[model samples]
Every structure is written in C-alpha cells, then in structure tokens.
Target: MPVMPSSAPSVEKGPTLRNDSFSDRRDSVNKLETGCLSIIVLGASGDLAKKKTFPALFNLYRQGFLQSSGVHIFGYARTKISDDELRARIRGYLVHGKGGPPHTHSEDVSKFLQLIKYVSGSYDAEDRFRLLDKEISKHEISKNIQEGSSQRLFYLALPPLVYPTVCKMIRRFCMNKYNHGGWTRIVVEKPFGKDLESAEKLSTQLGDLFDESQLYRIDHYLGKELVQNLLVLRFANRFFLPLWNRDNIDNIQIVFREDFGTEGRGGYFDEYGIIRDIFQNHLLQVLCLVAMEKPVSLRPEHIRDEKVKVLQSVLPIKSEEVVLGQYEGYRDDPTVPDSSNTPTFATVVLRIDNERWEGVPFILKAGKALNSRKAEIRVQFKDVPGDIFRCKRQGRNEFVIRLQPSEAMYMKLTVKQPGLEMSTILSELDLSYGQRYQGVTIPEAYERLILDTIRGDQQHFVRRDELKAAWEIFTPLLHRIDDGELKPLPYKPGSRGPVEADVLLSKAGYRQTHGYVWISPSL
Candidate 1:
C-alpha cells in the first residue's frame, strides 16, 4: 500500500515496498528460499537459550517451518560441552503437550537434534568465531549451496555486556557474504540498556554494523495472542471504536503480578528491579498497542509508526504519582545484599497529553512475589450520567483483557439479579480460549516472535525510536530510585503491595475490584 523511500537504506535489501495482504507478505518471505538457512544461537548453554531459543527452534522444525535438509542449527557458548550434552540439556524444555512427558516423541526429537551442532568459544575472540564459520561452511558445502545463496540468522541470547563483542565477531567472521540471493539478520533480546544514554550507545554500536531493517529488537509481549489481537478487536469490532477514547472511558489499569520470587536470581534482579524488568519494556509495549491510533495499513512500519506517535505523546511520570516497594524477606536470600534497596514492586501513573487521551490516566503496575500470578488490562468506562435504578453500588461496566494465567476477554456489566427483589449484579460477556478453542494449541510468545524474525516481519518487534521514547519516560524516575533519593516502601511477600498503591488508585478515581475473583474459562 505504501512504499519506503528509495534512497533510504533498509536492513532488508532490494526495493522497500509494502505488501498489500497477508499472502503477499508470506509470498515475499517464501521467495527468499534460494539457498540454505543457518540459525545460530550465540548463548546456547544459558538458561534463556535452553528455555526459549532452542525449544522455539525445535517447535518450528517439528512443524516443518524450517526445511529439514537446507537448514543448520549451531549452538555457541563458553561452556565446553559436547553436541549431545547441549541437546540433552534443552530436550526437557521443548514443548511436547500439556502434562505429557518431555521425551514423548523420540523420533522427532532425534531429527531436530541432528540439525544442531555445538561450538565452544570465548565471546570476544575472533579466532573462535573463525572456527564457528568453518563449521557453518561445512554444512553449506554439504548442502551444495554456493556463496550468497544461504541466509544467516544470528540470535544473541547472551547478557548485554557481551552483545557488542559477539555482534562484532558475527559481522567479521560468521556472516554469509556471497551476494547471489540471501540476507543476514540478527535478533536481540530485551533490556536493551539500563537507561536512555546506554540504550543510545548500544543502538549506535549496532547501527554501525547493521541496517535498521536487519536488526530485530524483540519485546516478547507483542507476540502474545491477546496482545496481537488488540488491533483486530479495536479496529474491526464496531462496539469498541466509539468508546475507545477518554470521552467514554474513565481510566485504564495495566497490571502484572507474580506469586514466585526471583528465587536465587536476586544477583540479576537487584540491579534492574521491577521497573526496568517489566514496566519499561513489556507493559509499555502493551500500552502503546492499546492507546495508539489506527495505522494507515497493515504494513509493519505503518503500525510501528503509530506506536511511536503514542509514546511521544506520553508525558514523563511524576515522582509524586509513583510508588515503589520492596517485598519482605527480599534481602534474606543469600544472593541479595543485606542493605539493598531495589524495588520488587512499582506503580506509576502515565498521562498522554494528546487529543484522544488528554485527561485519562493510564496506571501501570508490576511486582514480584505478590499475592497472585496474573497479567491483564482493565479498562473502566465512565459512569452513566443519569440512572433511575439506584440499586447497590455495582462495579462499573469495564473491559478486562487477561494476558496470562488464562487468555480471555470479558466485559463486566451490571445485570438484573435472578431474584424476586429488584437488584443488580456484576456479570460478564466472556470469550475464553479454553472453552472457545479447546483443541487449539496456543504457541508460546517466544515461538511466535522467533517465527516473525524468520519471516522478516517487524510489526511485532520494538523499533529503535520506540525504545528510546519508552526509556525517556522512565529514565528520570529510574535515576531517582538508583540514587537513593526515593526509598521504597516495604510490603510482605504475599500481600498485594504497599498500602499506598491502593490509596493512589482511589485518589485517581479507580475502583479496586477487591471482592471480585476472576474465574478462568476452564473452570
């Protein structure tokens, strides 16, 4: 529908024209099959790689998304392990079926493992990468793929400190340089940087080596089924369009909670805390999707452009409107410092100073070791101006979109009670995946994101400007917490959070839904 500037450089080579339909995009991706494809995972031995990267790739292979004969999977890490050891480490985490044994499909697992090879190397050394290149070349030669005929997809699953060096090594030694007909892409994990300055520095470093089109800065939340459905629900549904703005809505609550603590991972959690870990990246991305204007078209960059506009409209979070908390027994873990003041919980109010949402408040709340494990968006609509039935104070007519613990969308409404006496009760018009799509399997967020990277779709990935805008909103507050200028309130492990969070919401005209319990569709 739209075309990118001819003079502008893209990470993807050739003319930058937008695909008009889903089939068109699929056809474009399918057209890239001139040679073999190499999927190299850089941090193969780590928890993230084993838990997410490898399992996702295996699922793709099992589903026939990756051509069995033309593809090579390489696992490179500092750990000195055999190929069998690497496969064994990741086998348990690969998805089989719910509650099914991990080793159920022995044949499929064997076939997937056959494509995988392991390389032991230092992250910063060029010679080690040269060895890796040799291994990749061996596969290319066997497959009879000439230079520039194959594609290389490098996934950086390592810690942020090693990103620049590892990227440099991949660029210098491991890239597919034959110019016949192929592309090189890199997928980078989140927490891009701790703050704006560091994020910009990292962006600059990567920019020097790769075009913006070639890099995929991923936010796994965008890959969730419900998160992706936000667009379709708002634009396609007639019921939601008119009531989507501040005029008809009261406030929005975006929440994330976990029943489990960091366990022994406090060493990593203590540095970034809840705000950086969840609020800045995951929750903010969700907010953008919920609040952004309808895009010009379904093209990747078109949707991303609207997301950027929404982020740019958001004013910085006021310090007074923010509440930070540390859960009790946090420092008791041996990995946590005795005097550490990092926040395990945070709630902040963000206001968009734009035409559609000027006066509406968007409350973002995230915490670890709280009362329950759930993530959802609650959109409360404004009260009726005049109502004759002044019955009991029923909850407001609100839309609840559950992101996890169950995937569903339900509207809370006041309905007539089934009794002799005239009264009202809160009921729901629900659409839960469990009941509606019983036999269907919902892919994990990582699986979908990885597939998108392979297809070269950027709609669900976070762009560079969007990342910078998100950092700008939270950087000042992050600095205050880091400097000890603002001390976090303490709360018990199983409690909701500091009492101030409730008060903050109440003051901002939000109803708590204290007495209501969410029922999952399966139950």
Candidate 2:
C-alpha cells in the first residue's frame, strides 16, 4: 500500500488545512499551494469554461477544497465582458443536475460567483496578458498576500491552436517564479496533438516555459470514481492479482458508447473522428490502468511509470484488426462537410507484447449514436477445463466494471438455479453503486481532476512520455485514415455500429453471452 507524505503546507488564513484535503498526501512531492491563490481560466468566456471549469471550482469552493478567503477565480478571454456580466453568465450553470439545484444552493452559488473576476484579452498580445497579470496581482494584494508569495493557476480552456501563444503570455506575464514566491501551475485539456510529431512539438514548446511538474494534462475520465478504483480493485485484491493475466482472461473490452451523434460539433469532430476523439486518449488511458503492472508505490511517478511501460509494450496496430464506421446521419450536421468520411464509431484491437498480456486482446470500442449511452470494462475469464456442470453454455465467467450512468463492479458466474430442480444458471455478484452507496453523489469528473491539479498530483494525469507513447501507437493508423487509404464503413445511426465490428471482435476471440443480460441493481 502507498503511504502519505510526512508533511503538508497550510493556508495563512482560511479553514484549517490537512494533507488529505489536498491529496492522499502520497506519491507527489509538491507543496500544497494553500496560501493566496488565483485560478485563472484563460478561455473564460468560452463554453468549456462556463459549463465545466466554473462549476467544478464552485463545488470545490463550497466543499472547502478551495480556500474561501485567500483563493480567487479569474476569467480571461477576448470577449470584453465585465466581471459582473461574467458572474451572471457563470451563475446560470452552477445550479445543475446532481450536486446542483438552483433554489437549494442559491446562496452558495452567489457566494461562489462573487469569487470570480473576469479579464478580457487576446491570446498573443503581451499587453493584454499584462493587464490580466495586473488584475491577479491586485487581487493578491487585496488578500494581504505578500509580493513574493502568490499562487497562480491558469487553465487553458481554449483550442489547442492557440495554446502556444497563450502559454507564451502566461510564462512572460503571470508565472509565480517571476512575480511571487508561491507556485504557478497550468492545466491544459486534450486532443493534446493530432499525432506523435505534433504532440512532441507541443510538449517541447510547453517544456521550454515550465517544468514538467508545473503542467497538469487533465483527462477527466481518469477522475471517474470507477476508473480511479481500478488500482484498488487490482493491487489491493487477493483474488484478482493472479487471474488478471493472459492465462485466465480470454479477452478484455473497454467500451464507450453514446446515444447521440456529434450534435453540432461536427465541424470540429470531422477533423479528428472517433479514434483521436475517444480511443487514443480516453480508452487508451483506461487501458493503461487496466493492463499495467502494480507499481512499487502509489507515488504519482511510480504509477505513471507503470502506465508508460504498458503503452511502450503495445504492438503496432494492424488494419485487419480494426473496424471503423461513420453513422448514416453524422454528416447531416450543417457543420460537417458533405463528403466527410469521419468515423463516429471505431473498434480497435490492441495487443500488448508483455508477459502478462501476451496473446490477450484488449479491445477498445467507442461510438456515437449507438443504442445506449454507457461506458464499461468487461473482463471475461476463460472457461474451466472440465465443464461437468455444463456451465460453458450459460456463459463465460465475466467481471464487469461499469464506468458511468450507474457505477458498479459485478461478476457473472455460474450458480445453481433457485428451484427444486438440478440445474445451473448464470447470476451476478452485484455491487451496483446506486444500491450500495445510496445518497452518495459521486463528484463530477472535472471537479475531482481540478482538485488533483490543485493538489499537485499527477497519478491520474497523463505524463509527457506516456502521451508520446500513446500518440506513437496510433499515428500510423491516423495518417492512413487521413490519406483516405483506410475508409470508414457506413452504418445506420442508433444501431450497433457496422456488423463488421462485431465480426472483428469475434475473430479476435470475443464471445457474446446469449439469452442473458445483466441489469444494474436499483437503489
């Protein structure tokens, strides 16, 4: 088991601090930036900032993850909006589905909104960024923070094309190394780059300005409760440790399916398709956790090092083992080109050339406009050598980890029928989260990841080399698709993607259970 860091820093003025509040206080050696802190959203007026970024910050603020007195939120963009206008715009989103209901939390929402200040600026204009710095400095001064002790965090919620300029502006104008004794951290979102070459170039650019420790590459999926539970379910479990390898497991599937297509983001989706959008990053990150060796310690670096090894061991992808499909109505979106061949669905079989995973296929399937909306990991164990009970016909023993909608970990195993007859049937050992963890509102993925960034933990974030290894694995296939050599097969919207996808899965040794479906247990 991993142990916590011996000590942690505290805020000068605010609710008292504790190590676990920032992190497990383990693995990472970063000092908690607990004093006067400024969280600047670089693309503040944008949709991402309004929808995810601000809402997450508000949750952290009310939960005391953020220092109410010393911490401030800043919005920066070229929209030329006032602080009050930004506040009003942000207010509309803080009241949302699970943790949000306007009337119940109106007072807290208002208070949280008040902590945010907005600054308008161009991505490349040093003078405009200089104004942003001034506002940040002014807020720190007002909070009684000394000149050399101010924590500045800038979140780039903008498109990647503008990352270089925005990063340049932050490094030149707002970095704590230049203006304060406290630290400066930047959180950037993904589609880190389209391919390996571009990803490395971007990394080099960011590396020149900041140490790797100061940059947090946020992947919200990693923060999901189930995904975060992967390590515990594996390393900490006595039974799974032996059966997780190629010997007992037949095949593993990590799936992501959505009930709706791109909506109106087709213009952007057309350029990257499903592989870049879902597989390369989200599915692959999940694969790392599912396939990696247990790290020596839970330190962020140790865990990340194991993930890197898994990625590095993956063999080159073969075309015959891949299935790509474009939903019939995908191009109907006005933003999508009439002749666009962008795939809304894809299933890629990745094989890791390592002792534990050799001969086992790690199938990652993702699609938009499917029959359902859910994400899950299914691990099917091989059939027993002697089927005396005749349970093989019932189905193979499979352990499933559902990642969303209703979180769960259930095992489908053979059991005697509940009757006075001598018969066997497949039943589940269910741990449906809704029923098992009633009244527990799982924190939003963005909320948890943002907090980790504040805590300086990278165990859940992608490491630089890890990102490089991932891009290298998919770059060849991506280039082939771009060159129109590997065309996407067409499939109807709302259907299981092209039948060929299923055929590929079967050829790769995946057997679907017949006559039985596992329903999530209700609360």
Highest TM-score scorer:
2
* Residue 421's lDDT in candidate 1: 79
Q: Looking at candidate 1, what is the lDDT of residue 331?
A: 91
Candidate 2 matches the true fold with a TM-score of 0.94
Using lDDT as the measure, which candidate wins? 2
Residue 148 CA displacement from its true place in model 1, Å = 4.4
Q: Model 1, 200-312: lDDT tens per residue?
A: 99999998988888899988899999999999999999989899998999999999999988898999999899999999999999999999999998888899999999999
lDDT of each: 0.84, 0.85
Candidate 1 residues lying further than 4 Å off, grouped into runs, are 1-34, 95-100, 146-148
Using Cα atoms with residue i matched to residue i, what is each candidate's TM-score against the true structure? 0.93, 0.94
Clashes (N, CA, C under 3 Å) per candidate: 3, 2
Worst 10 residues of 2 by lDDT: 6-15
